[model samples]
Target: MLRLAWLFVAAWVVPALAAPPDDPLRSPAWPYMAERYFAGQTVRFDAAVRVLMPGAAEDPLAVPVYVDAGALADVREILVFADLNPITTILRYEPGELARPSIGFRFKVQQATPLRAAARTGDGVWHLGGAWLNAGGGGCTTPSQASGSGLWKDRFGEIDARLWPRADGLRRLRLQLIHPMDTGLAGGIPAFYLETLALQDSDGRTLARLQTFEPVAENPLLSFDLRGRGAVSIRGRDTQANRFAGTVAP
Candidate 1:
């Protein structure tokens, strides 16, 4: 009967449509590998479009992210996002009077997965850039010596100014801090670190703010340029609100 034929077609189509494609984040193509190898993985997408650029199987880059600012006339800050690690979002850099429209930094990738960098323009619309990694290592799990105990009890770090000129009177500064920036808990050490750092000038302004973590090396170093010049100061704190302050002379 015609009804029976239609039911058969419906059954076949329904079964086919019910099954979903395998997800690359959790269960990658390399099935022979261990599952923990792909654990804590994440990728970036907007409206279901994956933004990461896939590299050749033989490529050696650990993290790959495309940064494009040609779409906008003015840009604000480039926000980097990665969901696979303990800390999903990586870094955010504020351009702040810099002549360059695009920039990039070398960060340690924690896994073989997708990474994203998005630019927020003056108009407030966010644009995206992304890359993929082929190896796995938890940067957050790395160790630092100064994280805990009474050994560094009074050894807090310091910085001079939040923003200054780059010696050419270009309004740049060298901001410093004193902290162990512990990668994470290992043994008895605490798993504390600075997740973000920023500097604002005399006009109640922000010159630059960096996204930071244990993988950012010890005693984090950040230098940036601002617009105005006059008795500049800096205020920075880690996830624990441990403060690092400094001033620059005009």
Candidate 2:
């Protein structure tokens, strides 16, 4: 009876294992798309870096993505991209000496696509990680309802930051910035959003730098990993050439 039960389990499991993946975003066509975007650059599949996102996006306009490269040492920068979005390249992040090679942010998913994170270490190898997110559509083309009349008249560029201790002895810093992040896709709205952000310590030592694009959602929210506990500050510049700065306490 036990032998028959074992055979029964294998009968069902073998065919399932042999079946092709259901999501088109995870299909073979993604590699061709990635190659086109990289433009002859080498990308190696490495498990050291991980991209985390929901299997299916609940909200196409505000999908959360996390890239964790803590297992990799001496990482210089991490580049995030979505294969099927109108704007493929998401953000480029350069981590400082005391900063961890990890970042979390909310972004717009144009459709079902493979989201990738490439971490370039000191040795010059681009280690890649990816995740597939399924969405209905219209993440970029639709106008944001949050950007109503006079909504950002006085509250633009405001930042709120906080630090929370993690279980692994690493600190997580969360930051929220007020910005329109207009993609210029909506009628009559020109592109107006934060383009650059720098994180530094109280003594002015740079921690991390971020180059962002219009795909980021309205009122951008970001999170980073810190090695130790201390006060930190952030400075940013928008496409309009306006600058803003704020500090976070321990």
Candidate 3:
């Protein structure tokens, strides 16, 4: 009876695995969306922020922020500061945002916060995108999942790379490794992700440098768009000296 039940479960789950990826509604992260946004909330998109404070601080109180238009065409609801919080709240839509919608403004955050942009498409569907950032080190100073000293000694020379193809001959490349990017003594967990990513062309001219952290979602999927006509090499070294390397061409 146990064996029969196990087979029954596999028979149901196997077909689901064979389906295509990119089904946003069925994704593992999908549930988090509904938990974040709900009915009657107006969705905000492509917002610009202006910070009215003493030197671009991330504090919620002092920062003055809002969308550009007062009454959007089809706006159903509006949600502000859906990213980092003990303070995120939904600004619901009575009708919806403008028909040909776009928004921009300035705001302050005490630290880098994750920002979510959602649109209720013409087909009555919801689309979502997000950006994660730090107002400062409060999030970066969290504890790490691995140990210092030991992971450091063994992680030397470890490297991993992934190349994702994009339209218009652009390539998105990410390279990461298993090292405790320790900040020399402070030693925070999630705080220990890489602080900078430096990429170079085959000839060694620098291409790009990215600011990041462990909250960057494990193994560090560093992505950037680049144009090149030859061999490209990528390498990353964290504050803790954890290094990774890879090469790809398009």
Better of 2 and 3 by lDDT: 2
Candidate 2 collision pairs:
none
Error of 3 at 25 (Å): 22
Tell me the spans in candidate 2 whose CA falls farther than 4 Å from its real position. Answer: 1-37
Q: Who wins the lDDT comparison?
A: 2
lDDT of 3: 0.43
| TM-score (all chains, Cα) for each model | 0.56, 0.84, 0.38
lDDT digits (tens) for residues 76-178 of candidate 3: 3223343444334322212111011223222324354554545454545444444553455333233333553356556544656665656756555545555
- RMSD for each model, in Å, please? 8.6, 11.0, 20.8
Question: What would the per-residue lDDT of candidate 1 be over residues 31-139, giving only the tens digit for each residue?
Answer: 3221222232222233222243445223221233334443455767766655455555556666666323343333444565555555666765555455555554654
Identify the runs in model 1 with alpha carbons over 4 angstroms from their true place: 1-72, 94-108, 112-115, 132-138, 148-154, 160-170, 183-188, 209-215
In order, candidate lDDTs are 0.52, 0.83, 0.43
